[model samples]
Target: MRFYGFFRSSSSYRCRIAFNLKGIRPEFVPINLRRNEHRDAAFLAKNPQGLLPALEVDGAVLTQSLAIIEWLDETQPGLRLLPEDATKRAQVRAFAQIIACEIHPLQNLRVLNFVKENYDQDRNGADDWARHWIAEGLTACEAIAARHVRNGTFTFGDQPGLADICLIPQMFSADRFGLDTALYPRLREIRAACEALPAFADAHPARQPDVQ
Candidate 1:
């Protein structure tokens, strides 16, 4: 398996965390998003969306971070990434979507670039825009997390399932924009639990091979 991705991409970062948790080591093919390599014709041939995190496994291409994660979870059933119970699975999916759909898309590189080029916004302005959306999304997440906290650790329970996986990366990105983490104590606590685990710490952006 060859994972083509950018080191700084949160979506790719999510997949990296999943891979680490599942103990699956795939070849990392770094695509330099800084140089617009994702937009190149060769990359487009692999993923028409011109996105990072297009995984090639056994001559098959996989796109979308959530979909790729689900695939990994299903194929490697030994250590599941999602809860087995239907209701719990739904809850975890809901939490993941809050970050993946509502928050992350709005603050991603393409959206920020669009705001800069079309709205005449500067770097600080774009960062502010990102923070505004992240804070709003985290507000909702905190409420959900408070209700689901068990043993003062994981989001759904003691295990780091899908919800925790999604939460940690989003929080990492949120901190990048200087968002006040103190606003969400439950989230902060959950993040701390994940950070204590070696898998989550190893998958951190700062520890990625291409981080520098």
Candidate 2:
């Protein structure tokens, strides 16, 4: 198996956590997004979308971080990222989408670059855009986890499953934009619990092989 991704990418960061949790280390192929390696012809051929965290396995390529992670959970052994219970699984998926779909895209590098280039926004302005969306989305997440989450150290339950996988990377991005964690105590606590685990800690952006 070969994993092509960039270190600072939240999507790639997610797969690293899943890989670590499953105790599987594929050949790590670093596609440095800062250098526009993801735009290169070779990488684009693998994923036409030109995104990070594309996985090559069993003579086929898989794109999208969430799909790849869920595929691994279904095919591989060791850890399960999604819960088995139907209702709980749906809740977890919803929570994951709140970050992956709603929050992440608004502040993605491509989006930020577009706004800055076409909308006359400066770097600081682009960052402000990111912060606004991240804060708005996380506030909703806080309501669910703080008011309704079950008795557990991590999100969804005691084990760090799909929600935590999604949350941790978004939390990292939140810190980048200077989003205060203190305001979301439940999220802050969950993040602390996740980082305490070797699986999550080892997958941190600062610890990645491609980190520059």
Candidate 3:
């Protein structure tokens, strides 16, 4: 398997954490997002979406971080990324989607870049945009998780799973944009617990092989 990703991509970071948790090591193919390599024809042939963290397994290419991670959970052995109960699994998926589907797409590189380019927004303006949406989505996530009957060092359970996999990367992005995480206590706590583990720590952006 060949993993196409960028060092600082949050989506790629999520996949990296999943790979570490699954105990599988695939060949690394670095596509520099900063250099616009993802838009290139060759890379697009593999993933027309031209997103980071496209996993080439066997003869097929898998795109989207959440989809790829879910595939890994279903196929790989080890800790389950979602709960066994269908309802509980849906809750975990909701938490993950709050970050992936809601929060991430807004502050993602492409969207933010478009905001800056077309809207003529400065770094401060763009960051302000990112912070506003991140805070909104995170606040929703915190409220939803609080309503759950979950008690653990990690989100949704005693062990880090899908929620933590999605949360950690989003928290990293929040920190990058200088958002105050103290507003979301559960999330901050979960981030701390997740980062302490070797799987999460080793997959950090700073620890990636393609760090620039």
Candidate 4:
């Protein structure tokens, strides 16, 4: 398996966490988003969407971080990212979606670039846009996790799962934007617990090979 990703991409970070948890080490291929390598013809042939975190396994390429994660959960039987019980799985999925769907899309590189180009927003303006959406989404995420989190260590259960995989990267991004984590105690607590794990620590942006 070969993983194509950018070091600081939240979507790529999420997949890296899942890979560590599953104990699968794919060949790491850095796609330099800053240099527009993700848009190269070769990369577009693999995933026309031109997104980072595309995984090639057995001659098949998988795109979309969430889809790739769910594929991993299904194909790899050892560690389950999603719960077996239908209701619990739904709850976990919902928590993960709050970050993946509601928050991340607005703050991703393409969106930020779009705002900067069309609206004449500077770096500070782009960051403010990211923070606004992230804070709103995280507030709702905290509420949902508070209701459903079974253990203090993770978003869904005592062990890390899909929700934790999603939450930790979002927290990292939140910190990057100078968002005060104190605003969400439960989210911060869960993030702290995740940071203590080798899997999460190993997947951190600073630890990536592509970091300068």
Candidate 5:
């Protein structure tokens, strides 16, 4: 298997975490998003969306980080990223959606670039926009995590799963924007727990080979 990704992309980071946790080490193929490598003909053939974190397995390409992560979870059944029960799995997906769908979309590189280009805003203004949306969305996530927390370490259970996979990368972005995480104590605690694990730590953007 070959995984194409950019080091700083949150979506790519999510895939890395899931792969590590599941003990699956696909060959890392770096795609330089900064240089628009993702837009090249070679990459677009693999992922028409021109996104980072595309997985190639057995000559098949898989795009979209969440979809790829779920595919990994399904293929490797032993280490469950989602709970076995139907309702619980839905709840975990909802928790992940808070970050993946609501928060992340508003703050990803493309959206930030769009805001800067269309609004004539400088980098600082674009960053402020990202910070505002991330704060609002994570405030909601904190409450949602509070309701479902069981093991006191993870968002849903004792072991890190899909929810934690989503949260950690968002928190990394939050720190990049200097967003105060003190308001979300439970989320912070869960992040700390995740960081303690080698799987999560090893997947960090700073640790990636392409990091400058």
Candidate 6:
């Protein structure tokens, strides 16, 4: 398997966490988003959206971080990334989507760059834009997590599952923007638990091979 990703991308970070949790180490292919490598013709052929964290496995190309992770869970069923129960799976999926769909797309690097280029927005303005969306999304997520927290450790249950994979990376991004995590105690506690695990720790952006 080959994984194309950028070190600092939260979407890529989620995939890294999933791979680590599944104990599957694939060949890492670094995509230089700063240099517009993802926009190159070759990469476009691989992923039409020109997004980071495209995965090539079994002669098939997979795009979208959530889709890729779910495929991994389906194909490699041993270390299940999601719980078996339907209700628990729904809760986990809801939590994951809060980050993947609601929060991340608005704050993605391309979106911020577009804002800077088209609207002549300064870096601070761009960061403020990102923070606004993240704060709103995280507030909703905190409520859901507080309601669904079963074991007091992870978002859904004790074991780190799909929700944890999504939450940890989003927290990393929030920290990057200096977002106040203190408001969300349950979310902070879950992130702390995740960081203590080897899978989440090893998948951190600073630990990625592409990090300089």
For each candidate in turn, the TM-score is 0.96, 0.97, 0.95, 0.96, 0.96, 0.95
Q: RMSD in Å for candidate 4, one decimal? A: 1.2
- Model 6 pairs in collision: none
What's the alpha carbon RMSD for model 5?
1.1
Candidate lDDT (C-alpha), each: 0.90, 0.92, 0.90, 0.92, 0.92, 0.90
- Once model 2 is optimally superposed onto the true structure by TM-score, how far is the C-alpha of residue 101 displaced, in angstroms? 0.5
Give candidate 6's whole-model lDDT.
0.90
Ten contiguous residues with the weakest lDDT in model 4: 144-153
Worst lDDT window (10 residues) for model 3? 144-153
- Identify the superior model by TM-score, candidate 2 or candidate 6: 2
Inter-residue clash pairs, candidate 5:
none
Off by over 4 Å in 3: 148-150
Ranking of candidates on TM-score, top first: 2, 5, 4, 1, 3, 6
Q: Where is model 1 poorest over a 10-residue stretch in terms of lDDT?
A: 148-157
Better of 2 and 3 by TM-score: 2
In model 2, the clashing pairs are none
Q: Write the residue-wise lDDT of candidate 1 on 1-212 in tens digits.
A: 88998888998989988998999989998888999899899888888888788889887899999999999999974568898889878988999999999999999988999999999999999999999999999999999999877544788887787888888989989999888889999999999889999889999988888886
lDDT of 3 at 191: 83
Error of 4 at 140 (Å): 0.5
Model 3 Cα lDDT, one tens digit per residue, 7-41: 89999999999999889898999999988999999
Task: Give the total clashing residue pairs for model 1.
Answer: 0
Write down the RMSD of candidate 3 (Cα, Å).
Answer: 1.3
Candidate 6 or 5, higher lDDT: 5
